[model samples]
Target: MYKATMKIFSGTDTGIPNYSCKTSGPLAAIIEGLPTELSSQFSSLSRMYHYPQISYMSGNLFMSDTVKFPYFYRTVPSELHLCTGIIKLLKFFSWTWVSIIAADDDSSMRAVQILKDGIEQNGGCIQFIKTFSHSRTIPLEDMVNLYIKTSSANVIILYADKRYTGAIKYMNVLQIPQKVWIITAEWDFLSHYSLGFDDKNNTLTFLKTKKNIPSFYKFVREVNPALFPNDSLTDLWWKDLCTNQCPESIRRSCGSNEISPYFMHCDTIHLGNIYSVYNSVYALAHALHNVVISDSANTTMWSGESQKFLDFLPWKLHHYLKNLHFTNALGEEMRFDENGDLSIGYDIINTVFLPDGTQRNEIVGSFNPYAPLGQDFTINEKAIVWDSEFTQIPPKSKCSPSCLPGFRKLTREREPLCCYDCIPCPEGEVSNQTDMDTCMKCPEDQWPNQKRDACIPKVVIFLSYEEPLGIALTLIYILLFLINAVILGIFIIYQHTPIVKANNRSLSYILLISLMLCFLCSLIFIGRPGKVTCLFRQTVFGITFSISLASVLAKTVTVVIAFHATKPGNKLRKWMDSRFSYFIVLSCSFLQAVFCLFWLFTAPPFPFHNMQSETGTILIECNEGSLIAFYCVLGYLGFLAGISFIVAFLARNLPDSFNEAKYITFSMLVFCSVWVSFIPTYLSTRGKYTVAVETFAILASSAGLLGCMFFPKCYIILLRPDRNIKKFLTKNSK
Candidate 1:
């Protein structure tokens, strides 16, 4: 739509009948004399001076009503693409009310019709349509008044031609507060200087096109390069003919003209046009090339006969042109619909002018295809001309949700963006504990034990004996054992006189063995329970008491022998040797071990049974495992203590020389005191701590045996031992 002067500087030699390049050449010179008329009133002048005599000479018509010039296809897009795009854009922006400016011309009126239809179809309303005449001299003030008076619409769509003087006059006023837009073919009118006024202050915005035209052209070339193959032929022929026919005054063809200064801000539009022109020429040339090659290859060369060639020429040429892609050039895809109108990728141009009043380029910063009126998209300014090349089509929407075992997808809308679904994490698997988009993995040592609706706490797969309370109690027992062992060792080493050793002779060894066993048992139990030591735990308990009770039995026997043989000629003194005490303890241990083995062979350990509870399942455990083993352990302990009590009572009146005789009685009393209270504590405890507390009581009782039997004897031997050492040493030697 840019205005150009038809300055014909030369005329062809039409009177002459013969020409050197007559066989095949452009007929511009011979056709310049033809007459032509424009259907649109804007071109009131005949505009026929631009025609040439060659146009008539070649029997070519200068666009009669039925024969539109094929070379000049309209650069303006179809109303359909624009309307559809505007509807989408409006929807994207959530704008529903639009104000429209309809041009008086047929083309502009049709475009307005399309815009209105698109808006309505997209669930939007056009509040009003303002009509304007296609006057060559419309006053700017009048347009401004019209715009200011209109208030029903949030968006304005102008369908005016690009004369721009009127638009510029209205736009420059700065008083306008509303958004302004246009769908004009010639966007150069918006260039900084095109409107014959300061357009910098203009409120006009645009549905960007021609923005990425140059980038599109470059992309086509990179993707496919053989575009415009016959361009050289056109160039050479035109040059030669112009040289021969025209005066030297007009050297530049239409191709070489400097862009108008009015298009300084419209670089993308200019580049897009250039690319479109290049692609058009490339597509035509490729079609011609294909037709020519195909004809030559099939024609008979012997007699120079071309019957088949001519017959197929028109058909082949049509076929080639119909499907020609010419992919190496922008706007080169030459596909036509049934109506013979080409559908090209939509592009927008924002025109700008140069200093010499020429439109040189479209504004690269703000040109692209008009997406739906309000759709938000980023301008690819790197090659503003390529912005529309990345345009994406909206995808189809689905209605049904694709639900997973532990998840369900939720939809926000009933249409386009319905593809997204919300997912819920299963139980034992956490959703973002903090705010998050989706579910996350469960905590360590735990898993999604149930449905993934929520994450529940998990128990360790293996039993844990390393709890804080268990560990603390275990340390306390170990410390007590160490303290008692140190005291017992001192008594055994320093207070080893026959008197003290004779009283509770085996108690020291018994405590050492039992404490060592207690320490080892704790270590075995104080971690994750597994298959290894769990089965032997009950048997180990039996062994601990067996050895402990046997030590007490030996002590009681020693005391009995001392008191009985204190009278003249008693045989018990002869039998009261350390070997006899060792024999008694060994016999008792063998008996306990035999009973334990018998029961162990009778029935062994099994998986802990569990019963259903309100929260989950409660595990059932039996440390002694069965009644038989329990009774056997208790009976052995009672028998040992009973024998000790009897022996201590008999020896109480025997001699004051036997200083530890009193401790033997005290040892029996303390052992009974701690152990007798253990049964009630054990029965009341819920689970494993019962075993733990009982083990502690047994350890305490063993400590008491050491304390009472050795403390006084240790005092006598180490501090006040001058009275008893000689007598004790002689008694031991005898």
Candidate 2:
């Protein structure tokens, strides 16, 4: 074809062999696979002759400039689009670490540069790039070794034509299994040349053509040696088939005496590059049709029977070609952009390997540059056949697996963002999904689950009656209350007895009633905490214990005065009256009531839900509104107990019959000991335990007063009737 075009331009049959300088009549040329140097040469010639040249497969980036190649155009997309497509392919598969193999030429170098910039801009890294030439000095083995040594890239992109670098031959020899090879449109997998070493599962080819062009396939199938009798290539194809043993079916089908079924099957046909040629031809025909219509409607730029009109007609056709728009037989839009390059789409072909070792190309995906962002790449992953080594799972080409729930991603130091480590969510925070960059904190009423992946309602806790500790404390309070009631009953029954009359029997009655109230107050602490219980529990307990302590103090004072009044000092007898004892108990108990009243009116305790102190639990407890006020009530009670203890200790040796000062001193000692330890334990505990500690202290102190003060007296009064007599008590008091 090249020779024929050159012969026409040279005017060889017109007796002007050197008339190439006056070349004309050719309207335009659709050259396929023209080398950069040859295209440059033809571009210069086309400009001089005002003839337009449209290329079908020339991917040189330099041809994009209209100022430099005014008469040159291409139906195929430039290398820029191809580089962009390659980058998108790499990103889709997350193959950031990739190696490049390009032909040693200007076009391939520019393509590599574009690819490198694209990859780097998208947060991807290139491991290495190796250039190969037609020369044998750099052996294929050496290239393979370099690729293996310098790169851990699983994906290798090959960007060279078959003629320049024997890539298929070298690749077959290397037999690099488990590696994905990205092949450019410049070469195809020829079945005969594959040498049975081409692993289809490992190869992915990018083509600038649509799949299933039925018209083109029909054209290829109809071709035969009989129809093109003058074509020697077709005759050679027939002769080759005859040399081998032909199948009977193929011989009958092809109307030949001998032909193989393999030849007739037409399984080796590759239509990718050929489809581009088909589109290019249709594009030129559409542009010529428009040009002819324009010429017929306007003034003709020609004279009668003159070849001068042909010289200028090709230049006029350039304008029509520039504005051409049409749809091809395959129903694809064929148009060129401002740079005379077609907007092309690429089909991602997955090479499927059958169990029998035969292979075929399957269109599993496509990439359209004109699509919206993030939607340009579409892939049918289920249709893809991966390498045998990966089995059913897709090969992992990531730096790390996805971060699971309850974990977040931490980028590796000095590494790309894609390379990251997974870190668990902190204590109070949670991440409910995979690959979270940061974890979130749960709400106040909720807490993180055990896995820290979700928020759950916190458990409500209180000193409930159902708990063993609360039940035991309740039983103890009841028993002590009954015991105090029995003691009060015995004292009342023996009101007129000398043993009971000797002591301050009125103060004893008041003290027993107050102690019983103290036992009942502990019941308030054992049930579910509520607003009313929280407000009254502490106030009632403080006031009742204070009254009981005041009574004890009054009794101690009476014993001291009674002992001293019996001496020679006659004036002390007036101060020993029961009225003075009543005055002491009333005033002391009145002071405590005032303090408790102030606490209730000012800063009273209330039911509080404590969520922060302990995790996974909400402590339903009383919040002591004012710690100072609460302590003051306890301090006043202790002061009364202290006074009673001192007075009882001093008057313990008094000679009065039935002297109660010794028992009072021991009872105060036990009460002071139990309450003193309560402070630190109450402050140290939290949740239900805090309430438990206070309740235990109350029970212990109340029991101490009941056991020490009343138990001995009851023993003498009930069982030892002789010791309950006036003479026996007087002897013991001495």
Please report, in order, the local distance difference test score of every candidate based on alpha carbons: 0.49, 0.75
Scanning candidate 2 in windows of ten residues, the lowest lDDT window is 243-252
lDDT of 1 by residue, 553-585 (tens): 677666667666777988777886778878877
Question: By lDDT, who's the top model here?
Answer: 2
Poorest stretch of ten by lDDT in candidate 1: 52-61
Off by over 4 Å in 2: 1-23, 26-55, 58-143, 146-165, 171-174, 182-187, 190-196, 218-269, 284-325, 334-343, 355-357, 372-376, 399-458, 495-503, 565-606, 726-732
Global Cα lDDT for candidate 1: 0.49
Q: For residue 4, what is the lDDT in candidate 1?
A: 18
Model 1 stretches with alpha carbons more than 4 Å out: 1-272, 300-436, 442-545, 553-584, 587-705, 708-734
User: Per-candidate TM vs. native?
Assistant: 0.40, 0.77
Clash count of each predicted structure: 59, 0
